[model samples]
Target: MSRRLLPVAVLVALVAALTASSSPAAPRQRPRAPSGLAFYRPPARLLAGRHGSVIWSRPARGTLRLAGAKRALVVLYRSRSLTGTPIAVSGTVWVPKGRPPKRGWPIISWAHGTTGVGDPCAPSRDSPTSLAHGYIDYVYPELSAWLKAGYAVIQTDYQGLGTAGPHPYLIGVSEGRGVDDIVRAARELVPALGRRFAIAGHSQGGQASLFAASIARGWVPELKLVGDASYAPASHIADQIKLVGAFTAPSPISALGAEVLYGAAAGSPAVSISALMAPPALALMPQLEVKCEPQLIQPDSFGGLAPNRLLASGANLGPLLALTGRQNPAVSIPVPILLAQGGADATVPKPFTDQLAGELRAKHDRLDYRVYPGITHGQIPAAAQPVFMRWVAQRFGRR
Candidate 1:
């Protein structure tokens, strides 16, 4: 939430926090891309694997290591886009040390928040320390806590981040598929991973987890989903878009709108970046090649740009807006859901989540919505751990 400038390019280097040792050492640099993926070419065989099928895997070293995991592996697996075309997705999985329960370790499909659409920005390839210590407390103690409870964790980098394709960014279906397929791939790679699992995420991942809940059964019916937890999820995209359009000064929300508009353009053949953004903003798109969230939200990136200037005057954004809403629909979920929001979150305002809670309730979806009094978006995942864990434990039969 601090708008003050920080070195954004080094976000990947900050992965040193993932190390088990607490020494105040320099941040670990991001590991290099495997030689097989040197040019972002997934093997042709990877494209033919069924969704959630693992094509290849390698042990992750350097900053990709997990603190309490007995083993962590970087994997490339098969998944689909919103259009259902075959695509390769990448992620990392960490299995706890010690013997598994009789039923095997339950899985936590951790959908990550936005980083960038570029391959180098992939969290599985970069440093997960960002989750543990980066811009936000998005996936730390929650991930480690679950690991300590003897659960396996599968963290997806979405479709485009590590593999070839336009990362759909906030496109919920694409993100959700990434989450679902990773869990499936992990199960196949390690037969000991449990079929019963929960989906949890923060911010953009939160929204993705919800969509996963809607599709998990049909997409991968073999898996048994217990419940879901979404923390400060990106909801009400259309409403948030309008709010971003109204911002005069540079704002983080506007940056999100820009990034999302860029993403929509990437995923849709009908949508074009030129049509969605003014020439000035359009010209800046190249900068996104290397920058992810940390750099994109910087005031310097905006260059005094406003969200209203992002589109052609009077352009029909209805298609794009409709796509956003459709990708993140509000259909009733049969499984139990827990949504935690931060009252002080300026990024994902409280009202939006509150409205979502109301709609979900009206639909009779089982929900446990909690809003921390003074927490901000970045703090919600860590701060809400107690209640969050208790709920998950109940779903896990009082673990």
Candidate 2:
């Protein structure tokens, strides 16, 4: 039997056909933004907070009941981007009921995973039936579990998302600063909020948490960050780029390649979209920025990209690669770490996370790496909940 290498364009067209037929809204020209996110607009400059300071805060509409917490509100806070430019960020904070332990409730600064670079993709904008509601917002169960266990949860929307500007997706410094600054904003908003805290994240957030642990002492020295926990954290960016490039069609893997390219190009002025992607792929780059992850996953949204076509062959990826490597959780974490990885995770493959764990250990970073067999990337956080709760309890000196 003769075998033929599948043409990338054909594969993409097939994917598009499948997706278009399945999705009722596929016929629509422009995808609609997720519900409850259309009206996101922060004031021009509503009094700045020092770094993590809350510029202004208000009750988050329609989030209190869904979170199952005593109180929940959206806070528009101040955070600098990767380039150290002043920008407004938004996040949701849930305050649990009942009495505090005199020291106040310990905080769980939560960093979310990839939700697209679009402004409407912010986790705080999640609503009942929206895409974010399914992806990031559904974490209510996890957040509710923590609330029941008496830990306040603060979820950052990160810079550029939910407010204005180009979201610096996966830029460690930008993301980590957003995570750290939100905690600072939380403290300022909730007077009863405790200084003692832990950072927990899934996927991209996992990487952000690692970065947070490294920089917390210097960035926000006032907050007492005990430890960090990463669930299926992202690592090995150089290898990841290769993995994305290896895909031959318009699959989710290739979509990620396009997304990262867009992010890298957006973050650094040195890089240009046209320089990295071919004309066809470059034409679609603008869509990658405006659509949510779910929309992007729809095959029609991403025209199949040729292998190695999106990433320029001769372009020196050194600066971008260096930035990525720098964003990896350095072994310099001052506190202990709890990492949970899914053995069967395809998105963030087990080998990469295992290797990351080994690297952390080699640097003498305190790590409690736990692996759950048969679990996938999205399932790791919830699957490892029991372990996470126990580990977090111990970190807070609770039984």
Candidate 3:
């Protein structure tokens, strides 16, 4: 009886060992995106819904400790999609290191530029990581200066860049909508924010900042938008297409093309990105989505577009272009506009800016255009920050 019990005990231990060996182990956790999206995968529609819109009210406000300066980032307004959907559109009101304005002050609608042309991941547009990567990171120096001067700064992390949605590529209306909505959102946070506002930006944002005034009437008619100061903005897509072909430096065609595919996937009604690509391209989307841009997708500089076997990947670019040119052909809105351009701006070439200046001149005599001699695309704002800030301050009566 003792021997039989001993054998049974050994068998029970063996059974336990086998069971432990066969069990599946838990998955190791990975670091979340800086934006806190590693664990959350909310659908665009869900985020755009009523409950989603409410999330705008519950912003995670905190102080931004940076470069020995701890600035406060107050979430002034959370926006809803104009598609009548509730999306988490957040705008941060950057108050300089001073008490709130005892007297009314002018507002500066600080529209940011694009670092990457990709959706949500673009450094210029996205908020969380944007601070480290794109134009905003570079311009924070100027923003710091603005804060020191005692002015109210309103910065918006436009639709798809900081939040979610198919980044509307370079579409102007979408960009303008985000800019105008954010300005109104900022002003609503404080009544003194209504004195008068100026729009300022660089590169794509330059186009956006200049065009935002034209679009403000349609998106938010309540804000008292007095003027716009656009720096080296682009108006001619045809020209940008041409410049990409001539660019001798390393280009971003393939990545840019992938971004186009993603935008096409998000904007179209009948197509899905999964349904659009060939096997290899589909597999490439996960990694390349952030890196892809339409310009790189082209087979050659002289060629039209690469034949994307993608069903919706080849979605019509008309709406996209129309949305981008929303304020083009020059409007007679007569908003006091100050236009600055760099002579050597290759990205949004001088010709494009000159064309933009020419178009604006034909449209409004009050428009001011300054073409910096020998200044390149990126150097325009840097060389002109003091000039630009002075112009911005003048509109607010601080100059």
Candidate 4:
């Protein structure tokens, strides 16, 4: 049997106009003045503060605001890297209107799926009407729903997306810690916010949500993690890499394969890029560090290459495989979990999620797994919105 590469069109459509440039015919605009990117650069002294403590925060300007949010804030906070070293993370917090329900608004700590490893891909930098809006638009309505339902939402940009470190993409511990710590940062920023929160995410975020659920009770004991809701969460990453290694033709998912290699190498000292990547792939690595997903997946980029071509011939993948295998979110979770998958999702095949759900079920891990018949990967969040929102609400003890 042969593996079928995902159609490039599908991947392209999912990130439409992500790398498109402004028309040359348009009037020349003035170069934008310096902005708050400096906020991401935390002072050295602040790194010594407690993890999850707020370093600094300001009002979320322009399009960073959620539709139903009464107030929004851009925040930089302390968090730990995959190696337990202290790092700064940037994110946004949105508060609901007319709060004060005894203990204050419960939180929904949101983990977003892949945009890219680049700083420019950070969601906090997105305007509702900007080119980057394509990425935000997918989840904006869903986030607005949570805000409207009276849940305050906090979004983490992960370790390196908008911060000053190599993004340990798909490295579970780093991503999960960011997800968990941000909830604490939110509570610290807004004293009115309740300590209760439910971790929810899509794709990469879904995986992070599971990891966050597993470690929240221990990592941030001060806060209460009610449950986890993952929509088409990424799983079977090691197996996927093996499949990529076997591909002999151009693959739309090659960019993701490249990202996996980059992330694995960045997160662990034992995994070396020179030892794992082929010359062709190695030549393109600088772009991977700076380009967002859309640009990285263009035909001229990783998208035009076969996955096997990305790996050096007879490259020892053992270390890389072991590192990624550790990131699978199939382990036992300390809280109730709602795992939803899309039958039509090519990015994360149904069988992969089935195995993940099966593993958790075998552990009697308080799991609620659902499969939507026709939903694609990008559609899972929207398709499962009603169920997940209700599930999150139930966990928080609301209607």
Best by TM-score: 4
lDDT of 1 at 288: 70
Query: For residues 1-399, could you state the per-residue lDDT of candidate 4 as single tens digits?
Result: 223545666677766553222101111221222356887786676676668877778788887887999989988888988667889898999999885688778899999998877788888888754434576668989999999989999999999888897888899989999999888788777877887889999999999999988899888876778899999888889888887756888876888888888889789999999898899888888887667776777888898888889888898889998999999998778789999999999889999999999898998899999999988998988999999878987898887
Tell me how far candidate 3 lies from the true structure as C-alpha RMSD in angstroms. 19.1
Score candidate 3 by TM-score against the native: 0.68
Runs of candidate 4 exceeding 4 Å displacement: 1-35, 128-132
| CA-lDDT, candidates in order | 0.76, 0.76, 0.54, 0.84
Output the lDDT of residue 272, model 1: 69
Lowest-lDDT window of 10 residues in candidate 3?
49-58
Q: Which stretches of candidate 2 lie over 4 Å from their true place?
A: 1-40, 303-307
Residues 243-287, candidate 2: write the lDDT tens digits: 555666566655666767666766788766676666666777777
Candidate 1 weakest ten by summed lDDT: 19-28
When sorted by TM-score, best at the front, the candidate numbers are 4, 1, 2, 3
Kindly list the per-residue Cα lDDT of model 3 for residues 281-325, writing each as its tens digit: 455566533442232333442122332322243444454444434
Query: How well does candidate 4 match the true structure, expressed as C-alpha RMSD?
Result: 16.0
TM agreement with the true structure for every prediction: 0.87, 0.86, 0.68, 0.89
* Residue pair clashes in candidate 4: none
